[model samples]
Target: MSGVPTGSSGDLENKDILSYVALGDSFTEGMSDPYPDSDSVPNGRYRGWADRVAEHLADHVSEVRYANLAVRGRLIAQIRDEQVPRAVEMSPDLITLCAGGNDIIRPGSDPDKVVEIFESMIAELRSTGARVVIFTGFDTNWQPVMRHLRGKIATYNMHMRSVADRYGCDVVDVWSMRILDDQRAWNWDRLHLSSEGHRRLALRVCEVLDLPVDDDWNRPWPPPEPRGWRSARQEDLHWAREFLVPWIGRRLTGRSSGDGVSPKRPELQRCERYRPGD
Candidate 1:
């Protein structure tokens, strides 16, 4: 669908966007990425796609207020119950919602129920008359045990598309990127996206928002070196020990990696530029 034109939409001219709020889980919180220690980036803020998008918007647009309400390891329900209220109160001109990834990946998850809850959240956010941007969950085609959840992810993506249609919101189709299926796009955990992966996501979102961008994230990378079976098995064992085991234990104990974590950009303020030249 064509996006809303900035000219007659009354959303601030390209130079005067007031506020932009982002809401979601680890994907939005930018789990694997680190916040730079410079003045440009907030101390310990995850420079994830949401922040990346905000940086770009701030460069082209002026007085742009940005807030990231995302927290890592949050469920769709938690986002709806927790983040939705603040986002509604903020009532920014633009808002991004990228939840439900954590729910679809878990065992015994019901895609229909997840979609219902997600749609409800989107509906609530849309009521504020903000331009809501949503994302599809990528498939874990390269991961061994996680690949089985691909069908559930696909089901959730379909629901997201439907919600975007019903709510007149924008959808970033991350699931069909194909590049994300490659192991290189993932971090050591094999669940979260690497820094490069987040970069590509920022570009894709820029396209969805009808913003100018230099990189074409759809381009595939050069062929990777093939690993021997023994090496592959050893790497898999290490990943299971370091990431998978701990993730499972936390789930069993009802603990989350983001239990005490708060958002990096909790308030709507001027966003600093990130590598503007690039």
Candidate 2:
């Protein structure tokens, strides 16, 4: 990927500007969210944690450039073979990496192999004169079937922290931020993230990058109250009579209700994070 020049010449006033490169998988690609607009674009092209981190940085810093080369479903080897070279060519001041989810999902994939690839990527990024490298861990809700994968994820995170410590890079603990001891946070699929999850993640990334903190990032945003239980019950019954009854009838008796009922993969609820004074 080519380096996108950022900040005006006037923005640089006797201070060295920092260039950033963000690399990783679907979470890094801002999957499951609409792309943020340009004035909102600062950290990277993708609007995940990286972009949010950039937004926070914009409050305190002026001269910063970023390149995002993350793609959905990319494994460690693919990143090692492809993304690392492009990132190195950019000569970034900081590199943030989020990977290893796909590896955990694939059968017969070894965690040690994933670690090796990540370490190689780190070494290559460090060669680019980047002062600091930030590595992120997988969210606990990566998959419901692979619940045991958490141990592997932990192993990889431990390796990442050790490698970062050895090479003087920073480690962001995203896993802990999203996966608490409680169950209020995960999305419907028990994978991916809820809006609250993303908000918390964005705030933590800002903290790890040493960027200015936003108080709105920490406040709780409650869901809107339903019209009323009676109204909701009526609405539910109407839906059952209007849609569900016909769909079930068609499925059970091989009859055509002409409703075109196709089950869709469960989507995470699109709840917006609470902003101050909203």
Candidate 3:
């Protein structure tokens, strides 16, 4: 990998990854970012960064099989139990895992404990002789409520780096991506990335894979519109009511946004440009 730090044992000598399996939570599942001309997909399917990256890979190679086994509101344990084993069975040449964010943001959750589970998943994936990549928690300092969880996120990110090093895995360091600091990079809910944000992330992931991309993920944004104190507070209240409260309620009720959701592309298929209906 050119820009991404790698472990001693795993290296991508060939950029031509034949098969890729994406495993993780909402971020990997593509929350908030909708498909073109559709607010939602056939079955809550989201064309997230992982899908975009798969499409990019398909662009260069003759064929690349891909599957995204991610669902929203999944805890670290759920991912480890449900996704990791399936990925290993698929035996893909490349895998990208971004778990534990849901667990980390919860009250009283331990980053050390989360990483322990995370490391186990990576160890199992590496056992299949597959190249693995992991994503770090994003720096959430840009949002007021999310900023409160920054310490926990930072702690988890540190452990993630160490685990990647030990496993010889590649890393997508979202914590250091300053481009996401802009508000436009996030969806209106302020929880997941916007379409533009996902696009940028796709570019970053390609770069990490040593894949050629025409766009720059680090491009600067125009100046943000200045908001008065009262306006800012009103917006915050709206966000809380619209997004934060529902999220908290789900946690309290032990319900998930993905309670009955199934993985969009559960089976490995030839990567193709995501059309509106597909």
Estimate, for each residue in 89-178, the C-alpha lDDT of model 1 and write its tens digit: 998898899888888878899999999999888777887778888888876776768778888888888888887887788888887788
Where model 3 places Cα greater than 4 Å from the true spot, the runs are 1-17, 226-230, 274-278
User: Which candidate achieves the best TM-score against the true structure?
Assistant: 3
Summarize candidate 2's per-residue lDDT along 1-278 as a digit string, tens digits: 12322211222123355565677765665543334443442233335565555444444555556566776656678767767787777766566777776776555777777877777776667665565545555545544445667777777788887767665566776666534323334443344454455556777766655555645454554654648889856866775676557645654675542123211111111223323321
CA RMSD per model (angstroms): 3.7, 11.3, 3.9
lDDT of 3 at 225: 88
Using lDDT, rank the candidates from best to worst.
3, 1, 2
Model 1 clash pairs are none
Model 3: clashing residue pairs?
7-168
Clashes of each: 0, 0, 1
Residue pairs clashing in model 2 are none
Ranking of all candidate structures by their TM-score, best first:
3, 1, 2
* Evaluation by TM-score, superior candidate among 1 and 2: 1
Name the TM-score of candidate 1: 0.90
lDDT of 3 by residue, 1-278 (tens): 23332343333434455788999888999986777776457466578899999988887776789999999889999999999889988989889999999999999999999999998888888877787888989898887777899999999999989988877888999999999989999988998998889999999999998889998999898888888999988988999899899999999999998888999888899887665543
- Candidate 3 has a TM-score of 0.91
